[model samples]
Target: MPSTSISTGSAAGPAPCLAVSGASGKTGWRVVEEALGRGYRVKALLRPGSEVPEGLQGAELIRLELTDQAALERALEGTVALVIATGARPSVDLAGPLKVDALAIRQQCAACRAAGVKRVVLVSSLCSGRWFHPLNLFGLILVWKRVGERWLEASGLDWTVVRPGGLKETEDDLDAQGIRYSGPDQQESNSIPRRLVARVCLEALDAPASIGRIIEVTSAAGVEPLSLEQWLARQPQPA
Candidate 1:
């Protein structure tokens, strides 16, 4: 059976139908697995060349190139929300970040619009717009990521940007590692598990307060874990 039923989530309600575009990556796979564990129906979208992550074996899979708008439209059909776990995997090609990170996001937003998929949660980096950063050495990635975020900003869609700190892998005791959620640029450094990032993405879909906002997240072992609703309630609303 699919991991999470299309009826339950971290929020204690029926899970939403989630379409994840980068279901083959380490973090992407975790999001799919976590979503399943939480009772959500997942549609795993991937490029044909992307390696198949073993954990994603049971997900409903859609294979296609990002530039193929028709395929993107087809894959997103019936998806209640789109969780953009896709990113420019580190590579030798300098243009990969721009094409995949910036332009790809624009394409997905366009397809979402065409397919009536209104709610979108983008998995972005913590330092998305900064020109100076070590991660940018991999292709000026941060700059391109910001470009992608801007595209979504202008797409006229209901969107949330989950700008996470450096990604880490850990499934143990996530509830104990409280999340520090802040408005865009409120934070500059930290790390979080891919699983938590996925949960936050699902959380944002139902949070009207999250729309049009750029939320940065990081985790701390010493901090008491806080739910998205709790974090959001305490932060200023997006203007």
Candidate 2:
């Protein structure tokens, strides 16, 4: 199996309070849980009607619409960083992706800027920008996701976009899976457990080199498991 020491040094200081939007989703709640495990205080943000997931028990939960400028800003205030795990679910509504993935992301970026949250991590997907992919059949999700990513890139905050391949819910045997990390568009297909994706998001938060980069991830048993820092060291530095 791929062997590398993963460090939590990115968050070495007194852990900063973290804000996680979409805290009710499969991936979002895990981000909250992982952050709490890493000794960070967490604020979990959800839509007004979102159900409270059990994983959010220790977090401070705030319910509000992402479009509610005032509410979003208020929830983000005092948090040092924000992780946006929100994505439009598959639905009959044809415009859901435009509203949730693109528009909502723009709103969140504005709120982050207003709230002075300097660091933001966005959980996107692999093949996000392609128009011909099968995943785009649902409200053109991949297209909108790319739109959201572009907005974050221009948002003037420290940002990292983690684009993971098909997300699996399996938690067992995760320790045996080694993450294969690459830069944007490097990998088009594969799968990773949601749990691993969560850990990578937190790891990216602590790894300064992850800023302003789009990291693609997938995993399989026996693949080399390198920390985000180690993977980053192999890439050319940003100009």
Candidate 3:
């Protein structure tokens, strides 16, 4: 593993509070924990019936349906940024992906606009727009995810899309893995720990250069780890 220290180039002064939606999920909970560890006030938002994971205890929790425009806007109010970790689970219902990945994303973007939350980091998946991938068997999830990403890109908010590769649950040996970060479609298949993905989300929040970019991440032993700032500086800026 490479050195963990990477300059974030964070703006001068105190950081504002952040909101993390889908805080009860595997990756979502970790994002909340990492933000708290970094000394930022956090608001954990969840669906009305979602379980409150033990890891989310320290942060303020709000429960509401993402489809409820008014409630979603209110939950997002006063937060300077939002990290959208919401994702559809595998289900027999074929429309699940369309609703959760696409429609729900549009809802959140509308709420963000109404609530004045300008910064957003969305947890998307690699191969997000592909039509032939096997993952699309789950209701064309990748297609919907791509639709969601497009909505955010056009939302006019300061946004960065973190498209992580296959996620793993193992926390052991994390220090041995270094992240490989690149722009969209640069990498196709690999896996990364949820913890590293969570860290990148926070790092994107701190690094302004991440705005309007789609960053894909995967990790493996012997790869040099670079901070999001370091990686972004090396990419060509959008015209």
Candidate 4:
């Protein structure tokens, strides 16, 4: 059964800080912003040269390479959970996906274990792991994304993989856009605003039942609105 409670650290004090990797990215900054709005301290992690976007203004910024295990672990030391919003951008370098999507994830998982950050949420993509898809032309991105997901799944940490469809930049009238959630591969093509994707990443953190599951998301106007907990409640418990 899905736990109804949302953890705000221990009963004794302030909420544990949340660390969001790729904080300079479109979705990452939104996750950081949302976390802050929810009253949690946030650490926005970015690469050394990544620009500080306006969306990340209020959070503590830590700049470091994800491959630098020492630096990554240090940045995560005081954080209770890490939301991985990293993804390989389309670039001339064909190896970008392999490095950013796969190897970087392995490094983050290792860093999390070292830092004792037990909970993690990974923002992935729909059709991740599919080979024949057109998106694979770009460095076999989907394949590499699946590699990343598998790494987190086997890391022995409380983790949730949110695979959203083509991301949109528009944030207007978001309240009317209802998210359609499903198990892995159930959602193939559609689009959801990046803001909604950010919210679901945090929502997964609050829903204990989200652990060890891949939740695919897409949004449309007529779909019934449901929180992550509500959707999880309707599913059969894992045996």
- Note the Cα lDDT for every prediction shown: 0.84, 0.91, 0.90, 0.92
Better of 2 and 4 by lDDT: 4
Tens digits of lDDT, candidate 1, 1-239: 11121235367655567888889987788878877776778899998988888878668988999899999998888888788889987789999899989999999999999998887889998989999888889888999999999999889888889999988888898878888888778788889888888888877765777788898999988876788877777876544
Which candidate achieves the best TM-score against the true structure?
4
Off by over 4 Å in 1: 1-16
| C-alpha lDDT (0 to 100) for residue 55 of candidate 2 | 97
Q: Count the backbone clashes (under 3 Å) in each candidate.
A: 8, 2, 0, 0
- The residue-by-residue lDDT of candidate 3 on 168-193, one tens digit each, is 99899999999999899988999999
Winning model by lDDT: 4
Model 4 TM:
0.96
Candidates sorted on lDDT, descending:
4, 2, 3, 1
C-alpha TM-score for every candidate: 0.90, 0.94, 0.93, 0.96
Candidate 2's displacement at residue 230, Å, is 1.2
Alpha-carbon deviation at 70 in model 1, angstroms:
0.6
Clash pairs of candidate 2?
A: 2-224, 10-206
How many backbone overlaps does candidate 4 show?
Answer: 0
After aligning candidate 3 to the native by TM-score, how far in Å is the CA of 2 from where it should be?
30
Between candidates 1 and 4, the TM-score winner: 4
What's the candidate order when arranged by decreasing TM-score? 4, 2, 3, 1
Q: Which ten residues in a row have the lowest lDDT in candidate 1?
A: 1-10
For candidate 2, write residues 1-239 as lDDT tens digits: 11222243464566578999999999999999999998888999998899998999899999999989999999999888899999998889989999999999999999999998988999999998999999888999999999999999999988999999999999999989999998888899999999999999999887888889899999999998788888988989887
Model 4: lowest-lDDT 10 consecutive positions: 1-10
